[model samples]
Target: MKQKLWDHQLRARELKREALRKYGSTVCVSPCGSGKGTMIADDAIGAVSKGHTVQISVYRRILVEQIAERLQLNGIRYSVQMPDLPDKPWAIRDQHADVIVSSRDTMAAILRNGGEVRRSDLHIIDECHGFETLGYQTINKAVQPRWLLGYTATPVRPDGMGLSNRVFKSMVEAAKIEELIEKGMIVPVEVYVPVKTAKRRRSGLKISANGDPIQQWMSHAYGLRTVTFCSNIAESKMVRSEFVANGIAAEHVDANTPREEREAIFTRLLLRETLVVCNVGIADVGWDFPALECVQLLTKCGSPIAYWQKTGRVARNYLDEQKSRGVLLDHSAAMAEHGWPNLSPLWELSDREPIQKRQQERFGESAPSDAKPIICNKCGRGSIGLRNCPCGNPLFRDSQEKPETAGENLSLIGDAAEFAVGKKNYQKEWTNILYMAANHPTGSKSFAWAASIFKNKFHDWPEKFSVTPTVPFDERKRSIVEVYPQFMRRREAV
Candidate 1:
């Protein structure tokens, strides 16, 4: 059966058309499982039928294979560029495939080898947010596809360096998780964390350092296939052990796990032999399984990309038909700092202006202190761990006492404190966006749920419910403060 995208995706299609009219190059920010491949395939098939060729550049070989399958399923003739695979013939030649799907390395080699991109051919850059690398630079200068379209869910880098206008000129297509949930396309997420614990318990599992949180939510995966991410290799092993001890058919795999062994585990997962599989960085990106219903986040993730990607594992509809909304078993405070997946933040990554600068210019206000997340002192990525940051660097001095436990919640410590404020202010910062969501003609119960999350964590309803009134942005901010206190004062009153 040919799949029809949800209503929002249809709107996204129109947005893509509008953006292309405005700019030659545009970033299409479609959420996961919104039929990005379907959209791409539709264009490829139309262009191919018209006798114009197209080339799709991707980061991983797996993506190339996936795109080819989508094209084939649509009955579109296409060729892949993975010569190293024994069964498939080499595809390094020029202008041969009706629709070309290849990796950056493969595409760069083709261009370096003097392969030409015909003027009518469309070049689709998959995972287009990752355009900051040298490999992408090489491909850009060498090949010129007449029509350029880049697609990604999370387009903004955590380090704050965005794709420039020279690369992705404007946002062509966009949709939010809330919109998808309202349309029953993707599963909506319910984040579970005890917001009001009695002060701080000095012992047991230290809740703040992103401690072993899987045990808290592992039960949620009962009789369901799950993918869990841990903070480190040892933690991954421990989580796998916990699940195994419970007789849940669990296993752990890491970067060192042999290819054959890893493939075997995935095969088990496919056959319903393994209930849960745990890993660190490997499971964070491009690991697609439509049956994934729950994700247990155990990492102290500082990047929005990590949070969005991890939660997105379960954002797609479950194939088993036993589940409706996706359940997020978050113990690492990942959602607290970043807010919910499929919300406005992910959609805002394409802003030509930097968020920080835009806020300063529009409102003359600096972002909340929490907006400045702790970055890895070494790699300059976001950091939340006290000792060995996720990047494996020492974030604190030896002289400084590591909290008696490895994990510390949002307090005292440097980076922890920085992120703590962000977590505390998630609702305050996103008020205007949530207000528009709650009151718009297309508004949903999601706004009420988001408000409840804010009230639970911070003990107050978000105040910006009226911010998007019939007024300009500047007056909106001023009137927002005047009307915010008028909302229900506390969760208790409700």
Candidate 2:
């Protein structure tokens, strides 16, 4: 039996086909875990069925192997172009295979060695955000395929540069992150940022094993399968050591780690024998673990692309009931800078100016004001525009109570008087008010009175709340009655 593509995937394929027909080259942008591999396989299979050859180019050897596995699973004959080790009997270079998956470095080396690589009718570049690099440019120039297709979750580069009009003439975007979550294609995320820790200055070159990250994890996501992204090898190793000292099963891996050792560590994590894996740069891409529950950020990410990629690790849905939603622990306060990962920003295909210039133009010297996230004083969970924290704590607290910070300014959402109660409690309170108003002696006029009172109390319209009026009794009734006059006076003032 063949795998079926999702609705969004099918739409993306149709759009790509039209774009390719018009522009001869296009890149498809979609969120992580949005089935890019499946789409690539489907496209390659379709092209092969039409008697056209395909070449899939990737930056990493791991991606090459992963794509090869997908091709084999689909019963498609393919060849590999990677260095070292013996090749499969059927994957010989001279054999005419349906597709050829090659790493950029290996292809560059082949070109450097004065060897020729077979050009294909269609070329697919995975992680094509790096197409501006020399290796990809060289490969593109060498192959010169009739049609080009690049795929990436993020279309922008680290320096805020776009990939349109330079290499790929057009781009096809898939469903946004919020759409995927709503469609149950991916899990929702709850981000938490410490109030005090957000003020502490972090060194970019090194990370101290101060046990703060582990403490945060223990408080919020204890015993959950997590992946911690660190600044460097030394920091990752130290962080892993700290986790072990704290009696948590942890492993560390880097680019230099042997393949066998890294595979063993990953296997342990998959089996839940290891609770966390600390790494630097290795797990950013080409690694997929659906069961991962939390992504702890220990490194400050100035680039939005890197931040999104790191946070996307935990966004994938898992089968376990315990893994209902993903958790992001921002120890580095990257959330303050990059905003929530789920929000869809305007993605353009044209080239962009420097990041600093763009930021200066959009927002003065600081980060985007709209992207600022509110922190829960009680549980330290970070959210935006929610009256209640996921931990059931109220967003607004005593204004005088300041968080203990190092030396930097503390960033809070708003004053205590802004959001006085949790969303659930507010809804119930308003429902009771509406019920009382409907039964009041004023009759139809009472509903208008209640609407005015609710708007005054919550500073927003009550249309979004439940229409089924709930009556309050006992102590709740007394509280409502006491505040009723105050609500009336505020309504009268208007």
Candidate 3:
């Protein structure tokens, strides 16, 4: 295929080259599904032609072969120097090629063991979002490539760390989801926040019957073919189980699944044999399945960009004018809590309102008081009152308790407890609460960070006194702390 860069990609690449020329290190931030791999391949080809050795650091092995295949197709020669042949000389050492690709963890190991990268070579970090962690930073600092190029779907550090400017001299390119959607590369999505009358299960959790978080304006009547994001493997599995139990076809995949099975499931999805595919932390990149017309969020995450990325999986331009517009089945809480993607052009279309719209119009302009409980006491489900228990708990109250009602007392204490804990651990625990409440994908470090911060800042919140911080960003500067919060707060309120 002939090489051609989209307008934004061309500008991003031009900026990337200019950054490399000016500063030894630079960063490029682009939205998901924006062809990051293609851009990296093109850059490597140009650098090879200039007789420069390029070493690329990736987080996974699939990425290594993926980039290699792209470079090979571009007529650039390169070799894999993985475990099978670590002793092999550099691919560009013999003047046969100018780029080498390897996993970041591997490179870190080599460098820690006294390996050295050529001083004049270019260093590129693909999926630079992974560098938000300490281990990644240590590896990054160890394998200090003279010329650094960082690529990511988001430039902001999620762990309240100020790494935006530290990793690169400055951002060479910045493209938002809206800009991409305007170009027709991404399809606009309609968000459906299904009303959840079921009693809440946790203080901040408000997912759907499928275990996806419930948000304002969330809906599920769009039928199957929906892709929902979940908070963890447990949550995704819970979502899959609920869908399967409801007679809706569904499958779940996490980072731990076998490669062959994941591939098989992907194949089945492409063939339209499945109704829903639940994903956690794995579908962030290199995934293409155009049949996806519906996305669901079953997990909770801290990043609005991530929330959009998960939803954007189904909103990609299917290249078929006949394809129906994509549908986003949000948990009511996440919809109202994090808001939908800015790229969604649902407001622009008025030809016909879907069944969800008709139902929404009937539900009245505002959610009734009984529909918004102050707190769900039984399961620690917050903001749940006067709702029936999905499991049919006999103790369920009508949420209309009088001034001296015991249920109200219980709910208030639980709410106060959760709020107290959250406030105490706001810096660290916030991501988990956000994930649980918003139902987005996240990791353990986020939880650890929160717990440690709580222990340090509010020793009285917990039963015991202990302070052990795990995240490297705990010591970050105030500027870094400010970057993710305002965006996070906006998402939390959505």
Candidate 4:
């Protein structure tokens, strides 16, 4: 087997052994890029060696695969028990694997009504910050564990609720982001903030009424590689189109897209073949993009927790020390509320003062003198126009960039001779484009149970419910859907 332990991973292993031996349950608050997955894998191996079955649960679909790969490389045998996994639900239940990974939502659904879990089974909750919410309360209560481990970079939610101290035991083991940089694990970030414009009466609220985060972020997109995160899908599409109009080849992705397309877009990004990828909710978790340099947080996420998660997407140390710094285009209302440097134990919030307009204008390039006023092609709301409509979208002209065209053909159906599907293409290309989505796995059958339980609970449109794909579209594109006529011509000529 490969020796896959880092110094940080070793430290986490020591802590895990101590936590299980002493408290039987513990919470570890670690920052992003800190190799939390490696720690989990090693700990799970230790548990399995002691005849304990381990369950590792996370928030997103991609996390399961990431953890599984680490476990496999460690010479540990494990099974992924999730709704989207290829195997049937719990096929390996009686045949216990060293570790079983799942999504938190699927676990919530299973525990909501009823599910079988042994008292001796270890439960590891990744992205434990999400458990602070209400829906997770029921699942948290139902868990019967031999030991529980909660992991998160950010624990406190903006809503003021926190993970029950009972679950985490308050024994957190962590390393700061700066420390990771010094250790050569994460790159030191260089931050740039642009001057924002005001939102007029007829103008759409791009960031806020006074702080135009949208215009500020867009102005800096002079052919730089970027990713912009928004609050909703509609908003993500609108933002992507605005960038396209400005000459950036931008794409947007939400939960509504098929699994195959999501995989392809993620692959293209890693190849640096795509520029900007705008998103609503999905990109904040397990997805990795080494080419990711600049991130525009145009949306006003209600909590510091969401902000940090978005920032982590671009924080990975990709060996390009030249691209060390990350720019936070805080056009939204965060500056007036949470302030800069947010709540990080790594760096004191008071250490870095908020950048005022006077300071920002001097540090970076100033807005162009004849900068064309951004007119919402959808509603025709100019930069000098009103706030957003009651519908939450800008009441302006129709967008010139069609959402469909903004994405390359993501439908993965075709004749086998012309297309090739693999893990690399899925992660680097499909995940970044507009209209592609990856399904979170809890268990193959758990989604139905979750869907039934959460139907009346969440604001999700029931009509939007459909079977999600587990692998990337391009990986088996020709196998899943019919080849588009556009690609068909190339295949025929070949």
Q: Tell me the tens digit of each residue's lDDT in model 3 across 266-339.
A: 77766546657777778754455566766665555545446545766776676643343465654433433333
Name the TM-score of candidate 2. 0.72
Instruction: Tell me model 2's lDDT, rounded to 2 decimals.
Output: 0.68
Q: Tell me the deviation in Å of residue 288 in model 4.
A: 2.8
Number of the predicted model whose TM-score against the real structure is largest: 2
CA-lDDT, candidates in order: 0.57, 0.68, 0.52, 0.51
Cα lDDT of model 4 by residue, 1-494, tens digit = 65577776677777767877787877676777788877777778888888887778787766777777777767676776665555632233334566777677777767765776433378788876666563544554555667888777766554424444545655555676667767766654323222222221112234442224334543332223677788788888988887677545678888887888977776666554566788887777556665576677767665656766777766676664344334445444343233223123322112133223222232212424222223333432223223342113463433423222111111111111011111112222211211111111121222232233222211132234332322233343232113222221212110
Return model 4's CA RMSD, one decimal.
17.6
Candidate 4 regions off by >4 Å?
Answer: 84-94, 109-115, 132-143, 160-164, 194-221, 320-323, 333-343, 346-494
Per-residue accuracy of model 1 over 1-494 as CA lDDT, tens digit each:
35466566677667776666577677887777677767776667756877877877777667776667677666666777655743543333334568877778777776778876333367777777777653665665555666677887767666434566767777754567677666666766555433211011111123553334444443233334677888899988988998777556788999999988988997898666886789997766666777776777767566666777778878788645534545566655554455545454524444465433442322121334344223333533233334454435665422222323234222122232333334333433344234432332332325444444444333334553332223343443333224443332221111
lDDT of 3: 0.52
Residue-level lDDT for 253 in candidate 4: 84
Candidates in order, TM-scores: namely 0.63, 0.72, 0.59, 0.61
How well does candidate 3 match the true structure in TM-score terms?
Answer: 0.59
Error of 1 at 43 (Å): 2.3
lDDT computed for candidate 4: 0.51
Candidate 4 Cα deviation (angstroms), residue 418? 50
Summing lDDT over every window of 10 consecutive residues in candidate 4, give the lowest-scoring window.
409-418
